[model samples]
Target: MTKYRLFTPGPVEIPERVLAAMAKTDVHHRTKEFMQIFSSTAEKFRQLVDSEHSPLFLACTGTGALEAALINSAQEGELCLYVSAGKFGERWGKIARRAGIEGVPIEANWGDSPALSKVRETCAAHPEAKVFCIQHCETSTGVLHPIEEIIPMVREECPSALIIVDSISSITTSSLSQRKLGIDILICAAQKALQLPPGLTILGLSNRAAERIQEGSPHSLYFDLKHELKNQAEGSSSWTPAIAHILGLGEVCQMIEEEGLDHMIERHNRLSKLCRFGLTQLGCTPVAEEYPANSLTPATPPEGIDAEVLRKKLQNTFHVLIAGGQDHWSGKYFRVGHMGSFSEADMRMFLGVLYDALSEMEAKLPEKAEFETSLCSFV
Candidate 1:
């Protein structure tokens, strides 16, 4: 049998215990035992993001959660503003349009964060926008959009607009305070930094956002936030939920608590620095160099080396599964995920394997540095 380690931005390597937890006997979603686990998991998720309210669980992937956030709160044909710095950010606007909302996009170049001034100006221009959407981390480019900075600016410029954030890849890998950031709706997924599978999507709705959802008419039954909230109050979902994933979420939450959020964030930052330094030493230019994210590092190979080919060689030969770029950058770059249950030793092993693969491909490689200066900068 072949063994592989995932370095993709999503569906990250799950811990053995979490995998075992998901294998537990299935229980009815309405049963007392299931309800207890569901309630506890919801609370842990809230604490994970430092939120005032417990987030709701959706029996779908992150994309469905994003759609739910849009269709539930923003009405069709209403002005909805979106910040698009990369592929995921751009998808927010596309999702809005699909839901029949009028989407106004604010775009930044690939590998760049939108300027605060631009966002402020956009808010001023679209004062009637119902929702302002953005991503905490742009996974495709490894850009960590400064939600702390952008949130305050959005609130001041558009006081009435609901602020929705997609933190699918960043929630657990980075530090996020939903209440402090004044974010009205936060989207999360179990397949990313949460170290779980792809069947569950978690969402945190502010009091204001909840009120807004009630006021809107989505005309949809399955994604009605108001209806789901009612079901949640009774410790169930409007539809049959992912029972096994919920149990796995509980185990993952316990792991996060044992590690402590501060330590986990710090570890992610360290890994990011090491990954960037290592990639640079391998003659690859990392995207989002100025605002690198802890979740993953996207790198472009030097001219003449096919990024997709390198990724395949790493996977097929070394059993290391890193992700390739998406959308326009496809075949142009690759991303190495260092989030969730990864360690420095794992990184070293990955770098070694990558170095060997690059050598075999006859790719030009740079001399390795001691990484001492990079280590100092992380401090």
Candidate 2:
């Protein structure tokens, strides 16, 4: 039997209350009862993103939201800038190409965020660019982009550009507000810091973004923001919606509202710091020290130890499952997720198991140093 706890970046473990909420008797999407749930969920979403405007709901993954944001905000002939630093960032570039949109990508090293100065310079040169795409948190490398700094530069340098952000992993955990930041499109999913199961995708759109959609593009159908918004106004969806997922999202939103969004972000921040402190004492280095993600930590495996082997041992022996790196960093680094219904005890359990695994690998720590260091940060 698969008995290991999940610590992967996405599809994190869900709370029992949230799952139970999903198990409630189903209702028709067009029913007034369902609309009440939809409206309540949308309000919570606005609070999550700190937006005053309504957002579109989709029955797909984060990638589908990205596609919607891209196709709806810009057109086939219009130039769009895709900023890439990790695997998820690259996915945006690939989506743009497949949509036949004129896209120019600015790439940074896998473990680092794109340089704000470089992004500004590119935007200044491309005066005709219609949209600038960014990922708020790059899950692949645990790097958080400085969207606040980059967005202002794009606004000043390329006033016509619509800022589209993939906030799939950052929205609820990070310190970003859609209204304060002036983001045109903010995309997120239920499976991240929302502490719910996968299936429901949510997006917040600024009025500016909605106005731009009137110009239209040929690449969208079910993912079209205009269509979704119209259906949403009628208290319905464009098609058959994920009723259970929406119900679960409403329950998750209730939990978030009760906990308060600020407290939730602080909780993730605390867990992230605790995880980092424990990993550092284990002699592992962080991938992005300058701007590490609050939701996950990507740590380089100690020398002479295979990252995948360590991850496997943590799962099979200790029943503690962490994540492995993707793309170029695969087998070189492993990720530990600290988002969604996680606490200090969870962090301690993971670190204790990791400590045991390292000892089994014959990786020596300096006497009681690791434990002492972790206590200082965690306690």
Candidate 3:
């Protein structure tokens, strides 16, 4: 089977070294050897979030982590405030409904940022709200929320409400300090910036947040944060983890350590620009031109051209798979992912193919522009 070079958000193109790490001979989850690997890998997660406590590992996606965090912290029937500017933000409401909590949204249009006054008003009105859920980067619209400004307002207006941020798609691509932000719970997965295959969830909880979780009994045993806190402190999991994925993440940590996490983040930021520029030259307009997330770039093809058709052609014809819009956006826009394991050179390859594909499709383009690789080079 041929592997399509993935320009999709995730599961992105995993580097060969991470793949090799996952292929290493499996170790027994209960053994001393496994304990060493588990302990060290867990610390890497702690460092990733700049947290003092070692993070809990889960055998689930970011959504499952969201469910686990929500179920563990907020009681059933409690009032919770969430941002609904994009699909992932709307998920907080869906998860709340499933858990029987009343979720009120600080709603906005798809590509717009949630207003501070709106968020502040919600917290003031519902001071008793258990949690305020938000996405650090709303993946669907490629919008990065003003969490830095919003978090402090929540802390002041609603002292009791816990701040839960799902950084599923933004973690390594952006710089987020859990302690500095005073976030109760920060959630991300292995699939995105870590450049690994899916099926592992990394969660970090503040001391206050961890204590709050222990005070309440979670609805399910498997999603119980209290149990995870107890077992992970002893360098183990309450259940068998995705051992291979954990190992692969360890490999990613080593890679970042060598590349320097700061440099990796800056590279992603540059890649976002590179992709947006390339797409524009190939005749597409930036869909979320303002406050765009450095993780990906969403661009709309020239008038009357279907974005899904263009995306499919790029994937099937050129073997370069980028992402298309979701829901109302499905046919209107497409996204080119530049997060994790993608260097400037990889992005150049994608641009070359995309340019040819656009020309073949006869896209009505503006004056042609060169990539000017020298300007975008990381070297």
The C-alpha TM-scores of every prediction are: 0.95, 0.96, 0.96
| lDDT per residue (tens digit) for residues 93-131 in model 1 | 888877889998888998999888898899889888888
Writing each residue's lDDT as its tens digit, candidate 3 over 176-252 gives 99999888899989888889888999888888888888887767889988988898888789988889998998999
Our tally of clashes for model 2 stands at 0
Looking at candidate 1, the ten consecutive residues that score lowest on lDDT are: 367-376
After superposition on all CA atoms, how large is the RMSD of candidate 1? 2.1
lDDT of 1 at 364: 76
Candidate 1's TM-score reads 0.95
Model 2, 1-379: lDDT tens per residue?
8767888888789899988988878588888988988888888778778775787788888888888888887777788998889998888778888888888888999989878879988999998889999999999999999988999998998899999988888877889899999998888898888777787888788888888876785566777667777888666888888789888888888888888889989999998888888888888887789988999999986778889999988988888888898977889999988889898888887877788898898886655564866566555
TM-score of 2: 0.96
Off by over 4 Å in 2: 368-379
Task: Locate the minimum summed-lDDT window of 10 residues in model 3.
Answer: 366-375
Off by over 4 Å in 1: 366-379
lDDT score, candidate 1, position 346 = 82
